[model samples]
Target: MRCAPSAGAALVLCAATAGLLSAQGSPAQPEPPRFASSDEVNLLAHGLLQLGHGLREHVEHTRGRLGSLERRLDACGAACAQASGTAAPPPAANPVVGDAAAPETLRNLQVQLKAQDTRIEQLFEKVAQQQRNLEKQQLKIENLQSQVRLLAPSHVEHKVIKPARGKRLPKVAQDGDTAHNASRLHRLPRHCQELFEEGERQSGLFQIQPQGSPPFLVNCEMASDGGWTVIQRRQDGSVDFNQPWEAYKAGFGDPQGEFWLGLEKVHSITGNHGGRLSVQLQDWEGNNESLQFPVHLGGEDTAYSLQLTAPVASKLGATAITPNGLSLPFSTWDQDHDLRGDKNCAKTLSGGWWFGTCSHSNLNGQYFHSIPRQRQQRKKGIFWKTWRGRYYPLQATTILIRPAVDASAS
Candidate 1:
């Protein structure tokens, strides 16, 4: 093996190489940059400041809208409270008192109140949405401020700017939405529930029965599914009988809608007896109008439907003969009367009251004509003529259907 160079000789050679390299004069390396330039930092800060100002303006505008909605809501609440506090006038001592116009006035007032309530509810929803947007804008402004602080130069003094304050937003009306969803899962769809609520508020109380029969009170309530429920209540407020009726908004002019009453309830109350049923409506003007329809069982179950069309002048005069010898003007469309075989009772009629099968027949009148003309018939009473030649008074329930109206409008 070759011997290694001695330590003193290696050190002398390294020193000579360093001195030669220094004499050549190589350039020195520069240090890398750690921060952005002053101009770039200033530009970024300016952009952040503009965004912050825009957010502040938006927040102020939203607050103004929120305040307006709250004021409207307060007004609606006052109107609703006033409506509920007013009591209905007491009934006249006379059972046959007439107030035809009062009913209509009361109905209109109720409709207006309902409309106001609905408008308030819509405003509440809008306010809640605006509040959520305001929160998001605030958060954005905060983020922009943080970025500005990071980019700000050390020599430049930075001051924090606070957002303007406003009134606290009311809690959102989540209960209505939750209840609406829950109702759909169990009872009725959203549209139907609205119909039912409106109908309940608009229905009127009436006394209904067949000719010569004892009158029974029928309370009408609108179902959630846009149907009518007629119930007879006892003195203790318990229901005696109940009937379901379906109503559709059809026709034009005087008669605006139609109500369908099934034959099952008629059969239950009158049995094999046959006669005409009368519905007494007390108007706001203290005048009472009687709506009459023929109900003959004919030993079979058949459905009966009535049209809400204007009554013909010729038929109205003939049907206006009431038992009390008073002739009231017939304004409503009469029920369609049609006979199948020996079934002399009225079947379902289409279009106008006089447009059906019994148009030319002897029973073409508003009330049916039995074989014996001597039978006593009263327009305001419920009387049923049985096959055994005996007349019995009926106190039964009847369901009336009308077209579904908007809860707010109705």
Candidate 2:
């Protein structure tokens, strides 16, 4: 019963030591220990002192029991000798005196107890030494952390470079833009239609994440019916649309001005099979024309091929050409995926498109402010054949896309 508390205390101390060792030996440094303060160390030391006091009290109590047992035995023996003359001995004292092996067993127990006490004292000393080592390591860590804090500003200064006055700065992601992009991406609408559904009416640049893809900027054109995600816009020809395959794939342009909103982004926004495409074309005389059709745009694996069904709506009265750009993979000067064998439609027409036999529509063609003089140069301008043959370059063009289901419902 006396050894029970001591055994429990020993187990507690062993577990604490093991935990401390494992923490210190860890490969990855953990956050600063909570017990690094002087007050915590003092509290631990006080606990150890109390344990020592308890062990000393236990030892004294054991010694007192041994002394009391010897005195009782002496009294019992005297009582037994004078049993006939005096009275009979006490029943409790008689057992201690009559039992021959009791004294030897008690002595053996006393010896074992002394050995256990010595071992406990040794363990206490080891624990104290470990405590001291831990304190020193904590102090060193605190100093290192302080030094790092002091030197961080200097390291940052060394890494930053200031551009000279009147010198054009190199292109890099500005901190403000990066921060803005991050904030915009955190809560993004799936598409422009979603913004329209949520009661947004203004047309402007917006950030969107299609499906589960990374967020990117897009221009949302709002109409009376719904919002439209503008994929390509050719206005003043500030941006060249005749770029090679890579440029078209990654997209090149500004959302505020003329820009092509990349093929990959278009494919993602269009979803599984395809979506609806809305085209707005204006001739040099300001004769505006609009058309909508159900179109399926393939991915880069298919060279972003175009497959359009019959036009759902058209503002360009009746025309001879049908504007059918069906099942023709997109073509560029570098990578020709067009249907023509001898001539690259993109190279010949000086624009990129899903050119089947180099006809139909080339909305991504070269932009002209007005009518061109040369007859041969006329074919290179932005023109939709169904509205105004292939030679009359259109003044402006805007291409927008949305889901086919949404278009049908609208």
Candidate 3:
């Protein structure tokens, strides 16, 4: 093999070096300390800067290791080439000539070379994993830095806010827009909220306190059946889920169709809307299943909103499913095959997680991307009894509305 110069590796090394230097030590020196209104917040900035420097040190260490590994790899390649170039000795004139054993020197060298090759391969994998870990850590430190910036007076801002319940959305019902259901009622029962609102971030399991009382804990999980599933905490950090199976079975609390993953709710509105529902998820991998048609509660006159979005229009669009049991096409995404939400009602008392038949479905001359493309991948009409009887129609994008309470008067 011919040896060729590679600029790629050189570029990677340069970038890694530069990144480490910039993160660890700034070229400029700091001026004398000035007092700040919030000393704690100012200290936070200082602490974060220190942490950033430490993270930069860690990065430099990893890059140094990477550089070392690259050199070793290059050396291995050179050695391998040299070995290949030194052709094996021509067949001995006499097969028995080796009876005297032509010095085992070459033989040991070959063995050593093979062992080194194996070691190099192992090192490559190790270095790759290390690089990934370093990248992930750097990302975490950067996020911390972002948080620190939030402490700076120039970086922070204050804003007034109106209540969300009465707010008018940009797109009218006729214009095809919706409001998803979510909330921040910390005082509500633990079984009511699916996520915790921590100032800005929402986490799957979080701690919340209201009215200066003790903090309560909650864990979130999406069920096929509507209502909330909590990771209730015991006196210790242990958790329990004493929920009934019905609340979790397919076609009940979960999304109406196939999903990559699903959630019970996204609280934007504070009130108990109609028909408590489950989440439906989707992604690149396919999920073929029947889908549940949207079911609204209360009379037709009640005000309702939805929040839905998808790739592009080539597929179907995000939609608002009403309890009235009507199939309404709302929006479009990515050409036509991007995202489609077509409603399907169970004609036979039988269905699944979302609720729809499994099979090839062409969306009005458009493509519908999904998985489980086999006959068995069908959402239902068959084995839903084994796996909850609810199948989500792949065509059903998703539904977002505050679930309606079964006990609430319509």
Highest-scoring model, TM-score: 2
Model 3 misplaced stretches (Cα beyond 4 Å): 1-20, 31-129, 132-394, 397-410
Q: What TM-score would each prediction reach against the true structure?
A: 0.18, 0.51, 0.24
Q: In what order do the candidates fall by TM-score, top score first?
A: 2, 3, 1
Task: Give the alpha-carbon lDDT of every model.
Answer: 0.32, 0.67, 0.32
lDDT tens digits, residue span 1-410, model 2:
25435644755775786588567656575665454454554555555555545545654555565557656655655444444343333545534555332444435545665665565556555656655665676576666654443332111122232331111112343655564445343445667787677666767655566775787767788889777999888889899888998998888886657888889999888767578788898887879988787778888888888775434313322223356634668889999987779988999897677777777778898888778899789888887877888789988888999865553243
lDDT of candidate 3?
A: 0.32
Measured with C-alpha atoms, the lDDT of residue 128 in candidate 3 is 56
Tell me the alpha-carbon RMSD of every candidate.
37.7, 25.1, 18.8
Better of 2 and 3 by lDDT: 2
What would the per-residue lDDT of candidate 1 be over residues 1-410, giving only the tens digit for each residue?
A: 01112222333443564566455444355456345444544554454445434433543444455456445544455444455545544554221122222444444645654554454445445445544655565566567665554343211112332211111011232554555344333221112123344233333332233223333322334334443433111111122111112221121111111222233333333444333334433222344344444433332223233222233222333333334332111111232234233332222211222122222211111222222234343221222221111222223213232322332132
**Candidates 1 and 3: which is better by TM-score?**
3
Tens digits of per-residue lDDT for model 3 on 97-129? Answer: 223223343355445545544544454454456
**Higher-scoring candidate on lDDT, 1 or 2:** 2
Candidate 2 weakest lDDT stretch, 10 residues: 161-170
